[model samples]
Target: MSNVKDTTKANNQLIYAKRNMWTGILFGFGIVAFIDEAVFHQLLHWHHFYDKSTTEIGLVSDGLFHAFSFFATIGSSFLLADLHRRHAFWLKRWIGGIFLGAGVFQLYDGIIQHKLMRLHQIRYHVDVFPYDLVWNITAVIMIVIGIVLLYRTQS
Candidate 1:
């Protein structure tokens, strides 16, 4: 009946909205990663921000990997979102877990690799920096927010 049709339409709209939101989030993060690695590191030569010389190259490589992963994940999310619209509990759980893991890894890397070990410098140079704390806090906030979103989005 009309009630059944209306319910189906509403469900379809909800699925579309959820898929679009995730797609936007993934693409936004991917773009940020690309800018950090490609534009900032490769093109601008902004200090690799790491202590170990060898690991400097690895940092850039990791950035690239992150960019590619983000894109791939986004693509997969869209496909899975479409296919699992009606039965998305498992899919949501898996994606949420992945995001949680990635966020934790980034948090650890930022603290130990970047801050504790003093492998990487914050600014492009050793000169006095005004907004260093801001940058660091922002990174921490992003990691926390990512984890929270992942946890909340999971069924």
Candidate 2:
């Protein structure tokens, strides 16, 4: 009986941890996407989500990207609320997940989108090396922070 009870408790903890981590990931991704769209695309006019075409198409692409971010944020908020209601929220784990997700998203944007896919550069009329270096390094730092926190294994 004692062993069975212990197993069940451990399983529950695992489930809670996973839930918290995933919720944080979703939230982090959405927030980063929103920031990229608003700051780089709209405010600075550096580049659009898809800049392979005319300005009008780029604006439309930005709109779609914004919508995706909005939905991700909203969905993650609901999941987080559910976790809170169930008394399963884990703060440290959630934060770790956030950093992990943000780092992954940023890295993807910097490498795949900016380089491989040729979606857009960080800036149009500037040397791009510095921008790329800073972006990737920042992403790596966030990923390290997230890994450390997530692996601490303490509630």
Candidate 3:
């Protein structure tokens, strides 16, 4: 029947849209990670922005690991969003909450560990102030926005 055919076409279009959206988000995250790890770390010698001493390099490495973890979390969020479209409600909600919680924790860590304690510095800055509040704030804002968008789309 024509009605059945029309319904199938619409369902296929919805799936295609969701797939494209998630792919785009993952691609954007990859670009950001590439810039941070490759251009900033290797080419510029910026390495964690401060704590340049040999002993402090370990701490810097930890920070890099944390950064990578954040990206991985976002990728997982995309997967959850896709699953949600396929009727996996509980799984989607759990992943959404996890993403939101991780974003909040990262913001707090940036403030306390990096800014208050002066554990690291923002690169290319002449000032002794190690913490770049601007960068931290922008990161938090982006994370929150992404989480909100994901939640809305899933709902």
Best by lDDT: 2
Give per-model TM-scores: 0.46, 0.90, 0.45
Model 2, residue 65: distance off in Å is 0.8
Q: Can you list the residue pairs that collide in candidate 3? A: none
Residue lDDT tens for model 3, 1-155: 99986676456435554453444445445444455556555566655534646646745774675476567647756765665565433433343344444445446546774668765554545763434565566557757765775566552
Least well predicted 10-residue stretch by lDDT in candidate 3: 87-96
- The runs of at least 3 residues in candidate 3 whose Cα sits more than 4 Å from the true structure, single-residue gaps closed, are 1-35, 49-52, 55-109, 128-131
Report the number of clashing residue pairs per model: 5, 0, 0
- Candidate 3 lDDT score relative to the true structure: 0.54
lDDT of 1 by residue, 1-155 (tens): 99986677555545554553455345444444555556545676655534366765757665656567567557756755664555432334344444433444445445675667865554445662444555556556665665566566532
The list of candidate 2 runs beyond 4 A from truth reads 1-13
lDDT of 1: 0.53
TM-score of 2: 0.90
lDDT for each residue of candidate 2 in 1-155, tens digit (9 for 90 to 100): 99986676555556789888888889889988999999989999999999999999999999999998999899989998898776667778889888988898999999999999999999988999999999999989988998898898455
Model 1 TM-score, 2 decimals: 0.46
